[model samples]
Target: MLLLNSGCGTKNKNSFESDIIIYGGTSAAITAAVQAKKMGKSVLVVSPDFHLGGLSSGGLGFTDTGDKSVIGGLAREFYHRIYLHYQKEDSWKWQKKEEYGNIGQGTPAIDGDERTMWIFEPHAAEQVFEDFIREYDIQVYRGEWLDRENGVSKSNGTIISIKTLSGKAFKGKMFIDATYEGDLMAAAGVSYHVGRESNDTYGEKWNGVQFGVFQHGHYFRDSISPFVIPGDPTSGLLPEISEEPIAPNGTADSKLQAYNFRMCLSKHPDNRLPFPKPENYDPSRYELLARVYASGWDETFDKFDPIPNLKTDTNNHGPFSTDYIGKNYAYPEASYEERKAIIKDHEDYQMGLMYFLANDPKVPEKVRQRISEYGLAKDEFIDNGHWPHQIYVRESRRMIGDYVMTEHDVLGDKTVPNPIGMGSYHLDSHNVQRLIGPNGYVQNEGDIGVKPKEPYSISYGTILPKKQECENLLVPVCVSSSHTAFGSIRMEPVFMILGQSSATAAVLAIDAKIAVQDLDYEKLKHRLKEDAQVMLLSERLK
Candidate 1:
């Protein structure tokens, strides 16, 4: 059922052939491989990461599901298996079953009758992903880096083969680009866009920089000084605050939002590891946070949200908190070495902030005493020094496919034709840059928060590239949409839903001998319904 026709080191140096080839180790990547096997296809998953389940198996235990009823098919089956894993008495090792009470964002946590759970620990999620590979006998080639420079061989607008750095080539009839950065999509000569577009470009209201529209408490309420010497401009601005000119409202730019690690922490004495100071630790970097704390800001512990067994999924809290803003604008297109340096910088900054708050003498004693109780969870992320293996890349390159989904599609103003999946999260984006405000103080910019009027249907055309561009490739993770529209449809559950749907379409195209754009939607919708995928909310809940 599965094949690896060619070997790299020990055997012949020929090309390997398969029906389908998926190139990523994300949660969507695993689910797509599972769907390919169930649909009777010989598939292979060649990933850049050693482990699977990108963010879901990372530290993001607190899911961002807006509506649970919209999840079905292989995505729903994944959670149901997690529910069955907890039914056993031995599964509760760190904490007892009763001690792990039913606490979650929505619906019953246990759901004893339905046999499904929506929340779990990082390792538990990883185990379920591993089980999917074992149960279906899916062939996975790990630690194989893509040779992006001179790797892909294309002819007549179709990919003939893709090679790795180790000199192994994979020849397939169809390919799927499931990476968050869309590296494979760009290599295939497909058109894509990066960063925010102007409001006039897509007739959108929240696609550009928002100077006066402060959505949450992320902005400063009172005027705070940016210089080290209060009321003096000669001492120079602090480290993190920017000095760039703020653009007018609704204007376009090429800057991206911030990124951070969703750290898993614990308060238990036996399972906690103290946060150590990094080699390049500098206390002066957090002087701005010290100023914010002195100016009536005490929300540091607001986002240390709990998960299970006394563990907390800590996230970005306030203005000068976990998010490393204005530092990741070059990450999406950077080289591998450059990206590693950026990741190290983020790790050092976050770890240094924790140590400063708990040990530094300049910090207020009241705030330091409360934060000293928490540390990294010792049992989690054991292979990676108790740090999360993945950093949250919120937005990245988006393919400009046949249909560019705009705000009108999600705002319920126009009907989304050829529905494939459903998404209901808020149209959310973090602060892009922190620059000087109007009052000679510092303020955050580009934090727009807008929710949909209702759960709108997603279009099938958004995932298909132009027929002239490439006929054998389908992009689901980086689908065609504007910046504001991708924000609402970029949830983890929705990614898996689209992953399974795209896999179904790939096998159907392979069998029918047609391009992905030329396939009939009526047949695709029927196949999706047969697999228990929820295409509409009204029909799904019933």
Candidate 2:
């Protein structure tokens, strides 16, 4: 049954209508809904997951905020509410407030004067999102999966209504696809790209297959063999290593960056749950990682980033870590059942890896002892067996709209027109594939991290579809951008910024009786500024 709130009671049971319909349960969806209601417009959030705040509350507590100055609008307000929650004495259940230091991404987590906290626990972030929904009286339908095949009803180039898998239909004047997978936008027959574009296609240097260019430390520094038996090709390639032909440098490919759960782990004795071994645990599957360990590459605990309450936002760091590479190639366009299988495969792989590391005798004693001290936080994700509900979908189907944001736009080499928001994070793409290198060694490819010279503006046209494709839709999470450009814009704070900006545009377009593509940029800019959206760092810093 659909979990419809009081806002839907005024409408028919099977069909509900609103001024704006946001299809997702992400952090962006929450922000977009709040912004729409703030403008006195009716909004509905059709969420696929039971929980809100996608990755923001799904174990990604240690945020990837490059320049905190560029974060504003409802994004900053969300952090401010997180700060307020931690101020209460009862909020510190596992650790004292003073014991949890104020260190964030090279800055203070608790900024007293600014009244914001960048780092937080998963439940804390979810609580803030729930508060936003309750305070704004936003109507939400949880566990409503979008019927991608025959769900969207369109007239000419505009979406009329959308149906869910449960036979419930929703009608709205404007729609926002705030999903991480862009399911609503894809179902509406919008033009989108599935994989990395070549440098020749975008006329940018960092937009394609980065084979030999290892920018981050997530590559094979030492020679690690990729065979079942070292130096024996006849023994066949290892289990997880891909046998596909490697593409040339700067060329296009369909492979996507790896996906993993940003695990929230705890060292607290009373609240720690041991790493559960999967039903199909295979110790031999992590042979490549064991060999990497044999080659003396031991940086496994480098990315155990700390959040509040003695919990760590554990992320993929070294060569063979949490990221399950080369296993999600068909995920962006896969069916719901297929995607569930993929997610299950990832969970099994990660859990098997953890079990192998902590219990397997082949692992070094020192490494096993170090990892044995930590376990999944039993108090978090109480409903989902202490596992995160959302996977870190680094990149997926990006809409190719009227204006495609390339690496040049991200690097500030090309100017962006009609700015909606700003992003300062580095172009960070995780490893896409672990294949046999040219020199016959196991090597990872497609890990690139390049910082921008300054903060870059995200264009307003990014969220809009092509004029002929869809006129009333806005895509914030999977905006129009090249594979490399999406890396910088895919952060949680930036998603919230674009979500609020998208809603403001949706409401203005509705009031002015125009398409989202035809909305006046000046009017949108005025409202965004009035709502405290930071369009330019120079303007905000001044």
Best by lDDT: 2
Summarize candidate 1's per-residue lDDT along 432-451 as a digit string, tens digits.
Answer: 89988888898898787787
Cα deviation at 233, candidate 2, in Å, is: 0.5
Which numbered prediction scores highest in TM-score against the true structure? 2
Give one digit per residue, the lDDT tens place, for model 2 in 415-506.
89999999999998999989888999989999999999989999999999998999999999999999999999999999999999999999
**Candidate 1 wrongly placed segments (more than 4 Å):** 1-14
